[model samples]
Target chain A: MTGTGRETTRGAARERGSARWEARDGARRVTEGSPGGIVLEIAGLCVDYGDGPDAVHAVVDVDLAVHRGEVIGVAGESGSGKSTLAYAATRLLRPPGIITGGDAWFYPEAGEASSRLNLLDASAETLREIRWAELAIVFQSAMHALNPVLSVEVQLTDTLAAHRPEMSAAARRERAGELLEMVGINPDRLSSFPHELSGGMRQRVMIAMALALEPQVVIMDEPTTALDVVTQREILEQVIELRDRYGFSVIFITHDLSLLLELADTIAIMYAGRLVEVGPAKRLFRSPRHPYTLGLLSSFPPLHGEVRALSGIPGSPPDLRRVPSGCPFHPRCRFSLPRCGEERPQLVAVSADGERRVACLLHDGRQSPPAELGNPDAGSVPVAPMAAWGPDGPDRSLPPLDDTALSRPEEGVTPHA
Target chain B: MSYLGRRVGFYLVTIWAAITINFLIPRLMPGNPVQLLIARLQGQGTLSTRAIHALSVAFGLETHQSLVAQYWHYWVQLFHGNLGLSVTYYPSTVVNVIATALPWTLALVGISTVIAFVIGTGIGILAAWRRGSWLEAALPISTFFTAIPYFWLGLVAVAVFGVVLGWFPLSGGLGQGMAVAFNGTFISSALYHAALPAVTIVVTSMAGWMIGMRNMMVTTLGEDYVLVAQAKGLSERRVMMTYAARNAILPSIASFALSLSFVVSGAILVEIVFSYPGIGYVLFQAVQNEDYPLMEAIFLIITLAVLVANFVADLAYVFLDPRTRQEA
Candidate 1:
């Protein structure tokens, strides 16, 4: 209801060709169901590390949005640049990481009359005013993220004291206590230092601090990667519960595809500094159109199924310093063709009425995709479609996915490390 | 045991060990202070054996007694506020000589040190926080002064400010024959004379603190908490001071404690250059005259001062850092 106009502007920005127009039309066809509107809209965002010709393109031509009351999970390999996208959008990226191009429009009230601010272009004073009051971030590893010297109470109340100067000290303290309680931490431990608390409790304190100002959007940069499985589950559950209570949007960045499958309403798959595919979580899980997304989904073990062998993608994430040409993932793509090697594919809609969009040549209809491409039941089916492979199609025997890709899945995500 | 309790006990044992070593040093040496005094007295006039024995007992040398008995007598005399007589100062007692000089050294070095620490650390914080500012250029220039010896710097200061400029007194703790009184005239004269040495010490020493603090601040700026503090929408000054500098200053506090302990030793070369009546100047005269009693007293005080200062630092550390407050 509120983001209808945003659709048209976003469509107008990408005036590349007829294919892009069709993609724009396809985007317009998807039904808008978000309750409020788009809380944030990022289009054609680009981030580069360093300057001049030697700069590494960390985030390239990325477009993502966080609708009000929605969870958008960004899943990727360790160097796939998912975290870079979030930091660039939030204007939290440090030196050497510069936003080369982009527009990140934030709608604080998420309605027609709500004022929109481009975070990348905002002044220092304006950015500071909007940071914790309208958007907040919970960093990875609360142990290092929290000030070891300050008490939990001081840290939680710091945001309030900074943004809301009119509030009395007593009121701030009471609100800090309420925040700790909301995160299931006892308010009596507010005076304790970070070292005095357990890792789980420290992470809970971080969550409490992030939500202290009740910001409209929260960016969790792998908040639970340092935690054990039990604590991670508990924290994630609490996050979801809090989201429901506050009705705020979350941009959850993690490498764990399995966790995102359960938590995120929509999933954006990134590979080699670009978005490969984006779709509703259930649709992406059941029928991933992009080969990279299919590989990631199959890489992790299913939650409620019999034990089975799993195979990851054949190669590691490409080095940003020397990213592969054409489709960056073509080197590891199982359904790659000659055209995929020469022609760069843009993220366009898979079908006219569907919400799914993919950036692989197979989905572009120049060649026939594998018959089992979208079938959830097709476990590790060989995908050597000759028509798509062109005249120089390989021999019948194709290299199977090997153990080299298995190690990539186990590499943990450490935000800003 | 509590942390303070353990620290106190440790310091007490250290003091006892230091006092025993001070008592043994003169006895262990090839010649004795009493014999040296007797030799000087005999040169002036003939001395009888009984008179020599009387002088030795008066000085608490206890030549005829066993070493154990003399050690016991030494401890008894220490508790009675008696430290024998200073051979260099003749009739003056060692305690009186030290008391006369302690305040001058304390007032000059102690105050100058504190001023240097505050100024250096302040500049360091500003330099690191506003890197590329003109204040950052001050770092290498100031640090260059640390390479110059303090006594040499004192001489150059005297030649410039004292001789060429004629703005301040050149030497001594006070003007010639000025009585040690608490009157305004006497106090102002003393401060005027102390200005050169104090400036020299501060110029040379402040650089060390500035460099240390600046390096530490750079490291702490990269810490995750500083970034998080910035993200919390804190004002630039608040984030830089409360979060960044607050943690960076911890190591400086520990170093400050060490600096305090050495304050009693009095900047020996600078005192010599100024010809100031401080413990360092007195210690130099005692060593040259071989005034064993005076030297022993000063050494014992220096060791005990170090122990006490470290104990005070421990208390401050426990207060500042919660990690150290836990019971061991």
Candidate 2:
């Protein structure tokens, strides 16, 4: 709920930003009213895949508050459990992958006081009510998500019948036509089978279907990953514009940081089943605090500047079965300290802006001393600023990267210049 | 059109080669069919050279003629449907033998194969759609029947429904009292007597189709188009039948048509086992008697039937799948 208030303030700021820029040509006004701002509060979320030795702690002790009318991006490489967190939030994870712990509360604003529903603990009937009516999902592969034999009209109308049975057939058809137009599709193609449509158009149809019920939240798992660059941009732009127009929160999950930079309002960085940083997109993109977040951003090709050689993060994600002793990312961190191998750091507020939180030893406490260049043999390296350390420091046992370590050959590397 | 013309030319040459091979294999066998027929007619008595030479000429034997000359005569006779007279079955022409037997095999096997394919595919779609229900429960049962040897299943059907229940005739094409005519009463009686064996064939073959189709349907269910249909909010039933089943069933139809083409050959074993007087039973008699003329005629018909069946299957493929037509 605290995030909801923050989002409203952010919305007001966005409106002011829009008004100030409106005088310029082609500056369309982005209305602000806490319009699509719904609140999703998840607490003590835990997900485990089966029991005994085969079991996996896929998502552990996660908490997230997604505010409405904003695109919240969950970013991580494969095995970071980013997708698991998203699926868990919607209670969509199937068997063997059980939600061992958590409460996912949805606050849907329907004119009156918001209706609160806990997704994790709800009965099947209640879960069904939430699935398409309050929440919708756009899967990774849009082509795989459509039916090739059925016409688009039949596919669209099926969902309406399931969720809005009271609507007349004519009314449903009219609504479907309106939705197609809203999604920038030609309504005349409603009779066309999925195979007749292009990949991007199929994806657009998927998006239109998700919004058909006017759900409060739409979870898109790499929705445009399969699309071409131009189509991806158009689809994302249309989605963002639609979100603004209709007021629905979006949970965008992708490994594409550059794309997220342009679309998301907030970014939550996840690593090895835990959230390391959650902050405003601009803040996170400009100066990422977590070592993992820094590595992820650096890995991507820069979008708006002179070309630079891309740097991929060293090492694959740790095996979930045998996670590192202290910090899961300590083995790959460039600036790891001894303490990073001794004790796990909890997610706590960063001092630069208490609103932003990061879970790393480098940003733990208020007055922690700057780590000294403790290794006698190594030449002097500039210690990061005390303010840079913020409220956490790396666990002490992890050695900082030395010249020898940097010189070692690895896959996906170009030897840093 | 050119490609089709080339294919037809190729098929004609292939058939000719097959028939030539068929003629050579029997001719190379020890003991000539004509000598055996002559011995059986003459009671194994020592014959004079004059009588022996006379018999050979009557039977169209020609040692003095060149191999090419004999082959040319054979080809000319084949072209006119004069497959020569059967030496073992004296007085009967090869064409007459095949004509009497071909219809019985086609009717029994052809009709049964078609019925099995339709019923099996329907059940398969149902099984796939109603997974985890009783419909799916029938899959293992059908698969069990499918695995049972065809001859074994036929024997079992005959034993239980033929002898024990006395519901149908044990063998042959029709009831013993019924005359072998094309009249409705004869046709109905033949069908009635054929039911138990036909049912056995259908049950045994249907499993293959049902299992194959069900597996395909399951795979198609995972296709994106099916999910898109579901997402579009098409009713689950509509999505299952129209989207999932339609695409999945295409390959089954192709395989079915191909199988139907070969069904004539497959029925030989079943017909021989039951003494059903179909082409297979007649073919067995000819083979036992070393009746080369009758055997060649049957082989020619079967090869042509299979080739025609495959051609029809290809044409059906073009109709069922739009992608094929577009590619063509």
Candidate 3:
């Protein structure tokens, strides 16, 4: 038995080593015969926008794991490098915005075995094949993204023709109609031009297009930013409902923490291109460990909490061109210690849970209590009053109560809001 | 409805202003054309003061005449299709001289302008689509030709192709002994002689359209709708022609209309250099002999043509773009 245990340990180490090596070259590793839950694993990802002294580190030492049927929310203010992480993962980062290091592995679920594919090092042809097949994206500006001259039917059918050339014209049309219905849009409106649709309808059409291919992963970048509150709620509700029925993972990037808490299974908080803290949605919202995460939480009101003005984090995100030394977030961190300015903190597990990890000096040791996280005066950090917050506030009211809460699975409660 | 009515009313008032200015400008020039005509008719001898005054009154050239009376008489003469006699052309009426020359100028310059616009816009669209290719290689040559004066090109063409090679006629609307009649033979012969001058105009004017269309196409390619079209997986050719080319070509349409308005005036120097019996050649004779009525009639016709062209261009905006119709 001891010999068998040793052999298994050695085999596991070798597999891990191979995974690391594959990741270093920007490729995905497909592991076979593993319990099929995890769909994407991103490890040690670093992206730079330039070189030498002028280089901007857009994503630094970031790591995230998205499981099957789980919606992962990535929250950060603009320039905090949240969107860069998404772009880098998809290999869509253009020149001057380079992915210096990292591995984005996609594991497609198949019968009893899982197939892992490396995204970063894949051939252009392979990447093209995977695009809109296994993964898709919905950009923020729906009006600008949709061609004004094209009808909604053409826009949706176009993707099917490109990606699935074998499908007949009638089949493509039928699929498009089904997608529109799935996204809660009337089938009749498919023949209308983009200008004829409302902002919410346009965004829903974008969602339908992204979902048309039945992709395993969908990344949405501030999908509701251009919409009014009522429409925003309606669209988001439809998105959650579709995600539940489709059984696909999602990478939802937004600046609003409240919305993420309600929609995500796990949440990752980014500060200055670094993942400061990541945990289950409940734990991260209930008690965040990183100073930036704390600042982000206190800076906004909870949806279930009292109605009050929103507060905002002090200081702007550091200019990536000339980032501060050591921890990039140290300058803006209220709980920054002398060590924080001198040494960058590596992401470490907060407990033996393996589910929660944070990159902050305060969480350096595994045994540190949750209450002892960050500086003692971190809670009292000076933030602008909620009324003084800019247009991009995190404390907006909750989406309407009719939409089912797809992220919450522990409680048998049907979604009331 | 009210807004459209107001716009139409404004355009009518503008047309009226243009006509009034056209009528007033030639009369404002310092010259007693009636006295000059009387002196010439009297065998170049000095006319008596009473005879000169009587001739001035009869011609409605005296300052004592009411403005309304002079304008009414001018309108009557204009309406009757009479432009008086051209002093330079002996006893020929200005209208007759113009009538004899108009067709030659229209056939040559009008056809050249249309051909230039079509070829230039097509080449420009290709250049924009195939950027960094040999299609753009011809741009510098076109620019060089455009910069050279039309008259200089006419002289060169005549010298090389007519004088040296004897491939085309040197001067006149037809062969030297050809009869001047309105027949198929005469028209075809005139067209044969007009070829070299027409080529010069086409080559010179083509450059402006090419450069303008290319620049506009580049700008339109950068618009979001073009990018959206590309993202939709449309073929590169479809995207280029439908999304980029259509929008870029709009401004060229207005410019082409403006160019057409100038064709009737004709290129004076080119006509003189080739000795083509076009409107420009006739206008030159009028100017040299101080024939004010001929000059005024040509100027008035050219101005009215330009106004009508501009009105048509404005209407075209509604057809080419649906957004304009909505706003209007």
TM-score of chain A of each: 0.82, 0.79, 0.78
For residue A231, what is the lDDT in candidate 1?
Answer: 97
lDDT of 3 by residue, B77-172 (tens): 777987666666756777888888888888878899999998999899999887889979889999999999989999999999999999998888
Interface RMSD of each: 0.9, 3.8, 3.7
Candidate 2 local Cα displacement, residue B170, angstroms: 2.6
TM-score of 2: 0.72
Q: Global CA lDDT of candidate 1, please?
A: 0.82
Q: Rank the candidates by TM-score, best first.
A: 1, 2, 3
State in Å the error of residue B102, model 3: 5.0
lDDT of 2 at B135: 86
Consecutive 10-residue window with the lowest summed lDDT within model 1 chain A: A394-403
Candidate 1 lDDT over residue span B164-223, tens digit each: 999988889998888989899998998899888988988999988888888899999988
Q: Give the alpha carbon lDDT tens digit for every residue of A1-417 in model 3.
A: 999998996787578445532332225322321223666777667788887667887887677777766788999989988989987888777556887766777876522123577687787667767776677888778877776655789888877887789999999998888888877888998787787888888999989988877777888888899999899888888877777666667899999888888888789998878887887777776667787777777777766768856556678888877778777788877667787787766565553344566777665542343473533322223312223323432221222211221223443222211
TM-score of chain B of each: 0.96, 0.89, 0.89
Q: Which candidate should be chosen as best, given TM-score against the real structure?
A: 1
lDDT of 2 by residue, B135-204 (tens): 8889889889989998899888888888899777788887776667889999898888678778888999
DockQ of each: 0.63, 0.22, 0.15
* Top-DockQ structure, candidate number: 1
